[model samples]
Target: MKSLQDYTTVIRPDNNGIFAAYIPLLSGCHAWGQTPDEARAELIYVFEMIQEEYKEEGRSLPEDVELVIANAS
Candidate 1:
C-alpha cells in the first residue's frame, strides 16, 4: 500500500551525463537514466521490484526515515 512517493530518493547527475537515483532505505537498489525524470522512473521500477521480492521472501519492507540537511558552517 506504499506509494513510490512514500520513499525518499536521492538523485544526482553522474560524470557521464547520466542521472542516478537510489533509495537509502532499500539496500542495493539503484537506477540510472539519461535525465532526472527518467532516473526517477527507473527508481520507481526498482522499488516495486524490491518490494515484490521482499513480499515473496516473507520479509517486512523497510520504513521510510526522515532526511534533514544542515550546513556545517
Candidate 2:
C-alpha cells in the first residue's frame, strides 16, 4: 500500500460545495472536505482505514483507480 504522504491525490469541488478527495491508487476509498486542506487530510485517514480493512481480510486492494472529474449526467 502506498503511504498517504507519498501517494498522489486529486481534489475536486462537488455539487454540494464540499470537495471530494481521492487517491490515484485506491478504488472506492475516498473522503470529502469543505476545504482543500480538509480534503487532503481526510484522504490520509481514509487510506489508513482502507489499509486496515485489507490487512484484516487478507485481500489485495485495487490500485491505479482513476478519478473522473466530469459528470456524465
Find the candidate with the highest lDDT and give its number: 1
Q: Write the per-residue lDDT of candidate 1 for residues 1-73, one digit (tens) a residue.
A: 6777888889999999999999888897899999999999999898899989988998978789997869999
lDDT string, candidate 2, 12-39, tens digits = 9999999999976677669999999999
TM-score of 1: 0.86
Clashes of each: 0, 0
Which residue pairs does candidate 2 place in steric collision?
A: none
Local distance difference test values of all predictions, in order: 0.89, 0.80
TM-score of every model versus the real structure:
0.86, 0.68
Model 1, runs deviating above 4 Å: 70-73
Q: Specify the poorest-scoring 10-residue window by lDDT in model 2.
A: 60-69
Question: What's model 2's overall lDDT?
Answer: 0.80
What is the TM-score (0 to 1) of candidate 2?
0.68
